[model samples]
Target: MLDQAWFSKVGFDWHPHRGFETVTLVVEGQLEHHDNAGGHGVLDPGDLQWVTAGSGVIHAELAYRRRPVQTLQLWVNLPRRKKMSQPRYQNLRAASAPLVEGPGSRVRIFAGDINGVHGPAELHHPVTVAHAHYEEGGSFTHEIPGDHNGFLYVVSGSVLVGPDRMPVENGHTAWFPPGEPGLTGIEVHATQATQLVFYSGLPIREPAFAYGPFVMNDRSGVAKAIEDYQSGKFGPIPTTHR
Candidate 1:
């Protein structure tokens, strides 16, 4: 998560990533993204950038406007089978995103199902991701698949989660354990006006070897990734993005 007043002169320069997908949510201001695979866009509030750096990709992200920008980025790890899959990008604009409302709560689905309604972006792995807002005393309940592990990140305000009514405060996160062989119903209630993001995904259950921006299965894989990147296999940042 990043919340700051970014200036035009300072930003993330060209960087390389591999063996995972990055999901970025712009919540407060505009974010500009660019990559080597001809992917480029300006994301407004409520927008998302999903980039799969399977084999490798070079990219950059910076503030698009002169203002405060608050964004959250999640890295979805790839399984061993997909560690070297081709890179891809998806720009999910806010205008076409799906929304679910109940009482004083509203949820925007980005990559999952909510009450049988699915989100837009397709995934290599099954995952549920959403942003939600609630007024004081608002409540929401949803079922998560049994095999998935999930968490709720409180962006602001306070809320109670699960049947225990666990209190979660601002800048905190509540984790939900994996359930039994069937669906698990999770409930959330706002003690005060609240904003948060929900993320759930099936566990890969594989050993992860991470170094810098690369994640692999073992030390040898990480070495190979570094050698490949240094040998110019990831390719350079696109000229247009410059």
Candidate 2:
């Protein structure tokens, strides 16, 4: 949730988590991150970092302000079976992410494929993540898969989905039904520009039990996780900050 407003100070501190995956996408400047699993890196503009805190892990994200830092942090719930798996990480730079551009529009593929051009992000779930930009009167059609759930977060400007035309300004999100697949038109006035993030993921058919940073399947599982953390099983939190 780090935005353009808070670039002077570090946004988040070292925190422990279990049974979920965190995806950080840097749209503006840089984000430096380090974790208890011996993972550390920076996510620059157009870069993305995926952290799978399967069993348990502690991590922190600090905003690097050589330039303005604007990014999105998404927490995806993991399946029950993979919740106890080992922790992992994947960092993708801007140059490695795939892109598609037309007359007045451009698309950055962050997770899934668009017209057979897939992003470098490796996901355990079926997901499509993309950022799109459009000029005045420009439009692009996103062919969403019928099986996945899809949503759009407006970073700036206005868009038309189906027969409804709505203004999608910064910090707003929109969700769409799975079966409806058509041209999601984004039209900006000549004096305005538009940007939006699109994401779709396969639905987990299992129950979700969320508490603080922990997202598990059952109440007892959550209790056991807290006990494990307090018992020094995942190692004590690092004293030194990265």
- Per-candidate clashes come to 0, 0
Instruction: Give the per-residue lDDT of model 1 (tens digit) for 128-215.
Output: 8888999999988866787788888988899999888999999898888776756777899999999998889988999998888898
Worst 10 residues of 2 by lDDT: 182-191
RMSD of each: 2.2, 3.1
lDDT of 2 at 230: 89
TM-score of 1: 0.93
Show the lowest summed lDDT stretch of 10 residues, model 1: 1-10
lDDT of 1 at 242: 52
Point out where model 2 deviates above 4 Å.
1-7, 65-68, 180-191
Q: Give a tens-digit lDDT track for model 2, residues 12-77.
A: 778888998888777777888888767778787778888888899888888764445777777888
lDDT leader: 1
